[model samples]
Target: MTTRDALKIWIVEALSALGPSTVPRIAQHIWENHEAELRQSGDLFYTWQYAMRWAGQILQNEGKLSKAGPGRTWMLI
Candidate 1:
């Protein structure tokens, strides 16, 4: 899958594991779990923080996730 696609999946999985989380928390999870694989594939041009933000936006657009409260937290729908 493309890096964005991988990131999107990671976003969902991170939410499932952590409930509502801020962008940084999700990014950290992605880095911890998938950074090596993404780097090996030469697809990690952007930081995991950026990738997670984009993925969260995509999921929000799809109605599978939502931003919560005021702290820039995201949660599964």
Candidate 2:
């Protein structure tokens, strides 16, 4: 899948591993664990952060993730 599409998977994996976490922490987790994949993602490497935010919102809308709460951390539902 494209890197933007991959964010949905990676975000869930990060939360499952790290528990509820801030956006930056989730991003760091993805970077640390998937740097090689990101490097190969072309334009997505530059836009992943923005795309991740959208992915999170989409997940929330789909009821797979909780709505943004205090501290703006994300959690799987």
Candidate 3:
């Protein structure tokens, strides 16, 4: 799958594991869990953390996830 698709899946999985999380927390989880695969994405892999936020935005738009509270934490819908 493309990086974006993979990121969306990772985000969902992270949320399932952690219940709800901030963007950085989700990003860290994805990095810790999928570092090898993410590294395979080449130079762009360095930007994966930032890409998680975009993935969150896409998920939010698709209504598969939601943001809550002042911290804008994310959780499954």
Instruction: Write down the TM-score of every candidate.
Output: 0.83, 0.92, 0.89
**Better structure of 1 and 2 per TM-score:** 2
Q: Model 1: what TM-score?
A: 0.83
> What lDDT is reached at residue 1 by model 2?
32
Model 1 spans > 4 angstroms off: none
Best by TM-score: 2
- The order by descending TM-score is 2, 3, 1
Q: Please tell me which predicted candidate would have the highest lDDT against the true structure.
A: 2
Which is better, 1 or 3, measured by lDDT?
Answer: 3
| Candidate 3 residue lDDT tens string, 21-71 | 888788889889998898888765878777878888899999999997459
Candidate 2, residues 23-77, lDDT tens digits: the string is 9999999999999898888889888999999999989988999747579889999
Local distance difference test, per candidate? 0.79, 0.90, 0.86
Q: In candidate 2, which residue pairs get closer than 3 Å at backbone N, Cα or C atoms, i.e. clash? A: none
Worst 10 residues of 3 by lDDT: 1-10
Ranking, lDDT, top scorer first: 2, 3, 1
Count clashing residue pairs in model 2: 0
Worst window of 10 by summed lDDT in candidate 1: 40-49
